[model samples]
Target: MSHPQGKELSIAVVGGGISALAAAHRLVELAPRCRLKVFEATGRLGGVISTVHRDGYQIEQSADNFITTVPHAVKLCQQLGLEHQLVETNPQYRRTFVVRQGRLHKLPDGFLMMAPTRLWPLAVTPILSPLGKLRAALEYFVPPRRDDADESMAAFVRRRLGGEVFQRLVEPLVSAVYAADMEKLSVLATLPRFREMECRYGSLIRAMRAQRRLHPQTTHESGARYSMFVTLRDGLTSLVDALAARLPPGSVCLNTEVVGLQRA
Candidate 1:
């Protein structure tokens, strides 16, 4: 594309991952005639999100599906004309199991990440003991902290809920998702909404209820919408292939790692 000075525009994208590829695609879409150069340290694209075909089975190395609730990945796929290739997660067996005491236990229904929106499911779930459940339910009455300060996930959960609830429910679930030490993981960085909810409504359950009243989807959709998690029927490689095909010929430079940038 021509710059304001009537000169051809140029951009250098340094990576072969989906994020970098998406950036390059957007740049090209916005500036059709721009000289785009994609520098990749690796020979192949998609970075850690690699898929393998072995004996008619597709194996995903890192992440398999993208959630459509956010609309970015799905929009990109649609833009690339890969809509026909989109496939949703199987309706059956959509629940995740947590291992408690070396036994696999299904996560409580109506449980949205750290807290539960529905009382019946939370009441019936055996994930927590009677005392722990009572403490969790008491979250509705717990007053929120007045000061606005950043806190760790462990501290926030323990403060909002109770120690038993944090240990029995929140810690394990957070560990499974982030795999990071709870003490080190910042609640502000990871789950700022929960903090905001506490600040606004004084309790997670209260906040969730208010949110549900404001937006009916929050209650209707509740955690783990399997249909929202979509993937290419041919596997994630198809997305990379489609994106790569859209680039100008020889625009991608393999094995060229950009460690840093300097202003000219």
Candidate 2:
């Protein structure tokens, strides 16, 4: 908390979102003596991540779950002493469905986002047309883009698999999870491994097949790895509350908008 000149450090965090709160918490943990202030533009905290309880039901305003494959969120929860409140997804409902022509069809087995580990399932899936299925299968022969330049998720899927696969399968599945426009979402920022798979194995299908061979247990899995997701039993807002509780009193300034910054 002290500079080299022996002056006390003063830190200001702008925003009341989960990311800002987490950063503020980490700062307090690492520098207990520092003067820290959090400025929030809104009167409420947690931003879009809010959990509302009504009539014995918990409704999430935005993201309801966090993936455990990445350890950061789980680790943070542990640090906040909320590990006991963590609840896993129900085994009976750990599946995703896509609406095609007013009917809900289960995603193809081993189809995780854009890559399909099994060809037979993708071949027979009702989500894609016969031509779309054939086009997706042909992804194994499509040449990989060797450049390192960034591209949209739409462009990447359409180029590697086909327009039909992007519009029908990949578009819906990814959009449901991220709630983003595929045309604007960056492939590198979201699912970089698929791009790496293409660069390494020359084709996404080939890479997925090789992966399935190595991890035979995932052969029946589809869409995202739902088993890895979890949430607080009380709701995600508990995390924000826990974080706010750790900050010193009078440190949070809500409804304070910071328009610009000038170096001292």
The positional error of residue 40 in candidate 1, measured at the CA in angstroms, is: 1.5
Q: Give per-residue CA lDDT, model 2, range 71-107, as digits (tens).
A: 9999999999999999998866666788889999998
lDDT of 1 by residue, 1-264 (tens): 468888788789989899999999989999999989999998898887788999989998777888887889988999999999999887565666666888887777656667766677778777788888888889999889888788899999888778976776677767756658888899999888888888888899988777657655444332454556888998898899899999989999998999997642
Quote each prediction's TM-score.
0.80, 0.91
Show the colliding residue pairs in model 2: none
Q: Give stretches of model 1 more than 4 Å off.
A: 1-5, 120-126, 146-148, 175-192, 196-201, 207-227, 260-264
Backbone clashes in model 1, listed as residue pairs: 1-33, 1-34
Query: Once model 1 is optimally superposed onto the true structure by TM-score, how far is the C-alpha of residue 196 displaced, in angstroms?
Result: 4.7
Name the lDDT value of residue 137 in candidate 2: 83
